[model samples]
Target chain A: MENSAIIQINQLIKRFPMGKGEFTALKGINLDFGTGEFAGLIGPSGSGKTTLLNIIGSLDMPTEGEAVVLGKPISKLSSKESAKLRKESLGFIFQSYNLLQVHTVFENVEFPLLLLDYTTAERKKMVMDALEWVGLTDKVKSKPPQLSGGECQRVAIARAMVKKPSLVLADEPTANLDAANSHNILQTMLNLNRELKTTFIFATHDEKVIGYLKRKIFLKDGLVDHEEWINQ
Target chain B: MKIAFKLAFRNLIGAGLRTWLNVIVLSFSFVVIIWMKGILVGWDHQAKNDMEQWEIGKGQFWHNQYDPYDGFTITDSHAPIPNEFKPEIEKGEMVPMLFAQGTIYPQGRMQPAMIKGIPANQTLLKIPTHKLDSVTDVIPAIIGEVMARSSHLEKGSRVVLRWRDSKGTFDAAEIEIVDIFSTTVPTIDVAQVWINLETMQEKLLLPEQATLFSFANAEENRPAVGDFRLKTKKELTAEIDAMIKTKSKGQSVFYFILLLLAMLAIFDTQILSIFRRQKEIGTYVALGYTRQQVVTLFTVEGAMHAVLAAALAAVYGIPFFIWQSKVGFTIPMDTSEFGMAIAPTMYPIYSVGLILSTTLIVLLTTSVVSYWPARRIAKMNPTEALRGKIQ
Candidate 1:
């Protein structure tokens, strides 16, 4: 109920229908995320960490109780409404970078902005500004395939932040990168969070990802086993 | 929508091989369908045009009764075409007299032939009088030069016509040869002869009747006939040329079926091309394109290929049509049995409507056929689709 808490979850549950019965992914879970926090949702594979992130991301619905972001009940939003909300209020960074490989980095960054009816000049300016923030301003004309794994991840970050979304969900954003590239990406994301006051939510199993987050939630068998917050 | 198109365009470029393959398959299918439609419709038009040009004005009549008892009875009989029926042959309406028979003898040689009685100046059906290259002004009682030469008939030489009379008796008439002509259309030149209708009708005592009548009237409504069935110029040819048309249509129908099968084969390839690009479609969806947008993208691609293929077909088709027009297309048809010109030229007459509609149909069929599969690709969930599990 705190003013800083931008995301609220109350007894949220998610279950997948297997052969006959149900397989629960997220057992009754309660969590709250404040504004401008670098949080990690960490667990081993199939630990329901990704499912929990997806439910919060409004990409999937919770089976029981409420999952709210920006005070909007995400599970109840219509597909279009959810899409609009995701476009307006959230940015996504996927493990594979998910940059449209056919497009240039600038075009990719300008993609989310195109969904809104922004002026051409405004879209250009915002894209360039976000690309600069990721230190990829010179690589705007480069395609994803032309860039290194680290640079592609940076382009993904630039695309996510170009719209200035309230929350950014990065699902294994550094999974495809090398150890040095992973550190660089994590550092870039942390720096952007500090400079832009953008909240970062990460779903990852990497130790490097956990090491960088101020707050960590470890999910085991769909239950939140550990929760910690560090401010420094 | 623009973003979707842009994305689709970009994706098409990225997937070059798959896109072109689909285009080629679709274009090939379209060309086959269009080509079949063109040939059939063209042949029909050519036949109709030739019939009209021969001044077969338009309609034909047949006797319904068993036999004529007397002139008075003939003037008032219960025939399908009553004897009292006298159709007005106006300026535009050309009522050329036609008396047809199977056998005509020249000296020692006996040959089966089709003799058409027409006006001296009236154009012969076999002679391509409309040709810009023709040197003669009026076609003079057109006949096969081969027959004329073999018979050693000079100009103005008399030839005897032998045929069965109404009472089934043998009748003979002598007519002077006016002219002789050679044509690639063997159906006319090989077994056909042309003479003045008035001369032949009087020579044969043909009840002063015309077996076929053609009237060029723009009237939307035709006047009622008491007993004789009134027909348009087109309808007249239908009656006189019905047997020829029926045979031609049958052959074309067979050709059409074969061509349609070929088109379907190409269409099957297009479908396969679409199936093969399922992953590419998943990539499209993951990029946030809508279903309709995706459909339009592939549809445009299909249309592009159609245009290319249609152009290619036309390149080949036009020359083929011209070559056939000059040399003629013959199938050794026998017109002796029916008493008509047997060596009809298979001239290619292009129908604009036929070509346009057929091309459009090809495009529609290919696009519609490509839709469901393309839609399946467009509507797939990125979460599952990007997983790339073969199903």
Candidate 2:
């Protein structure tokens, strides 16, 4: 089955101005990820994978062409509108675990919902539910500093899923973890994707990370070098 | 919003040493500004008080200050006291007062001093109310403690005083010291003598109404009695305050410039902070925070530091003001030109306006002083913010 497209990019370009010249980061690219698909964007250093992720995440404006996610043409949204969309529809996970270090595991998971002005009781329920999904309900009171690598990644996963967004964008989420920790975190994220049918998109250079995904797109020097599907 | 505050609080603790250092610097700046504010206002108050009491409204009032001749006639014709100015002299508030240089001869010792004669009814000179009631004889005098001590003369002891009379001529008299008094202000308490208005009129040998005139106290609550056109202490103070205002014309601009300088420093610190923790800011952005949300976090962080510092200062400063209010601060007599007779016993009058205005200034200074860097952090592209960290 070709899972229905959730994101589409076409003729995308990004340029940077040096003192007297311009450097092109993304010359042109075309790609698509289907609904409920676990996908990885892989590239070498300076290959512009992170740049592509930023554009797709609505964290940046594209210099040219179209990058659309979840039926929203991100480039067309005003800054405030774009921010609202991200808050309501997207989740993010980062390599550093990005759990607010001062908060307990429960608070870290509940942090995004706080911005939504949910009542305390609702927040508790949602956060606990997310923690359970990550097998971290027992560590709800623990701060990030107290957690091991695998547990920290689990907390990050809990935070992302707590918002219950349609899509999750992760940038090098397992880059800081050991091999076993990376494998465990990937399995946990894939398990959540299966249960919730949420789309998961990753920008990474790790072969181990790429192997877990059902779809893969590889970029070389800002151009799409290959796009493939596995076990479909 | 709660997450913003929580994150801000966390950022402060996460960089404990730097946060504390900012607090210390901020507190020091607060103290310096407040201390300067107190001293300037204190000095102006002291100056005005002395002026009203000593009969020098704006600057020194001259009983013929410009006239080279001694004891010149102040008639309605020759050195005319303006007819319009008469009611001021007639009223007790601006009563005619005279000054003359004299030699006081106690036995064989003679010392040169200024003898001032003021109306016994006028309380603006700070003659104690109880003592005013006790002054029964017109020819008796209030001699400075320094003069009395030097002369070895007690109250009721008679001494000879010689001076040039109102007509540019010489005159002499023998009078008893009715009161020997001292003021913390050294200028007035040393080398001086005070006599009743009538006594100095007699000694200076002037006609019944000859003396220089100035308003007693402009800050007083008294209504205007008549055409008393004497310069009020308030008018004099207003002039002086206006002059200082002109001197400090661009103070707000200077404050802004200082705030800018402070902002630059804050930016350097915050940028260094952000640089040192590049991965941290990147992590926050990646974790679903908008640029505005990030800015709000840092700005609130800056405000918290400012408030914390001000609160600490207030904790110490309020009690200091209270102690100062009850006991008063005594500036030494020798420190000012006004002399011991005019020394100020300053009691700090607390005003909520002062505290509130000062706190706002400090908070604004800190926030404005710290905003540039916060914007820098907020405006950063996520790629640049996460540049070195994602690999």
Candidate 3:
């Protein structure tokens, strides 16, 4: 990966309200991700990994310090500006597969493109192409309820990648999948990362997900403990 | 807005039975409110038309002393027909009616009745007064169905009529019922009888004198004459208008209740949807929807139920309303018993304005109810919502 940073963080702290007190989920966290980097925030539950991912994704704001994605300070962005940023340049994958249950696989994949101003033909082509990347082209007509856990995850991945966003934030993406399904999903994502040169940041403690990461940042009690790099 | 609509439509359709239940309830409100309002409009139109055709004509010129509700006023309400109306009366554009109170004994049963004398050949009113000229040995009289039923008098039935003339001399005679007419106007039908004008004048010893003159039209600029009150059609029908206005207010209460029930269903569904679909809401936000946009999506989803309800109402209500306009709705009891100008069967008339306005009202009400609960979405934390956590 190039040395250009797409995401920058400096002394970021996040506190959440907890009846009569505040719980600090992240404390003085410093991190940076570059273009096309396959990175994971590796930590156990309550380590604030998901909280850090949420901040980077512009879904949450920092209590102190700064987090900037695509050169825009997330803490200072208005709700509308933050939404526009996410719409134009970000994608998300969740552990529970957050695929719209009422929609067909193809419609779910086409949702992000619909938010943009793509024409009907362009949207159709993009959705079909994204479905093919996850090998779910044949199951495009199926609903989420009809799909297996792994298939649902594949659909979610296709939906996230349909717009070809600059960054993808995945929070324990493979937690609900079996071993084989986890590996298959990870391989597909890794291939997309290489082919599309898209930056991917993951918050996960799962070994299957950690195995696919090129760089791992270990977090403990809302602080980074250490970091590791793998040579593929 | 377009994307929101498309998503809302998909969400509503995908919601399956829950969506349909709310829609069905809302549709019932649409049909029933329109139907009830239509009936009142129909009744108002019919009552005015019947009064104009049968009793009031276009207007009336009554003697200044005439008080229709007071029976004692009949003694002094008579005045010689004005000479100014002579031309219209000769042209058959006006009819003079003379009124007197009398008692009738039909099969030894005593009943009070109003004696009305209308021109035998006049065509201005639809009273069938020409039947009065066919009498031979007895005076010819026409009574309304209600008067006939109550007095046990029918066409061709003879009854003893007792009255006093202008000379204060009591008179008794036999009268033959030549016709029994049916009319929706209670004032024209209940406890009233019609006879030849000349016969009534001659019997009452008051020639060339009448209580009221029914005209084909109310002349706006006509000079006021002494000892007469010129009542326009509107003025003559003011009581009916006041009655209908009062009735409409009562009907509005029913409309409010119907709307409340439908809105409650929509409100309850919206609240439940926000609670159950928190993750979907978060997914929308994560997919780049602002929390405001998420709230709008839910509101639109709730309001779309009204659109669906309108369609469903048309499916069933169109046929039912059309059939009702044709066959009409029958009252279980006698309309005359109500002492109003009501027909035994009433045909409903629905205007496009009424339908469109009713639809707009229902649509707006449902939108408000939906928006009330959907505002909760704007306060939800996207991070917690993404985990499907209750906020």
Task: Identify the candidate with maximal TM-score.
Answer: 3
| Tens digit of per-residue lDDT, candidate 2, span B1-391 | 6676677776776667777777666665565455445544554566556655654543223333334134333321122344554575566454555667778888868887677667777744554322423544435677766667777888888888777776777777776777877544444556777777667776676545434555544454443323223344555456547644653455545545544554455556766765665555665565556777777777777777777678767777667766766776676654434432234565444456656776798788677656657777766766667654422
How good is the docking of model 2, by CAPRI class?
A: acceptable
Rank candidates, DockQ, best first.
3, 2, 1
Q: Which candidate is the best by lDDT?
A: 3
Winner on lDDT (1 vs 2):
2
lDDT of 3 by residue, B1-391 (tens): 9999999998889889999999999999999999988988898888888888888888888899899889889988898888988899999889999999988999898888889989999988888888888846999999899898888888999998988899889898999999998888888778888888998999999999999988896575555566778888888888888989998899999999989999998999998889889999999999999999999999999999999999999999999999999998898887885777888888899999999999999999989999999999999999888887875
Cand. 2 Cα-lDDT: 0.69
Error of 1 at B70 (Å): 21
Error of 2 at A126 (Å): 2.6
lDDT of 1 by residue, A116-172 (tens): 789999999999999888899889789888999999999989988998888898889
What does DockQ come to for candidate 1?
A: 0.29
Query: B180-237 in candidate 1: lDDT tens per residue?
Result: 6654333345556676666556545565655444445445355544444455655544
> Which 10-residue span in candidate 1 chain B carries the lowest summed lDDT?
B62-71
The DockQ leader among the candidates is 3
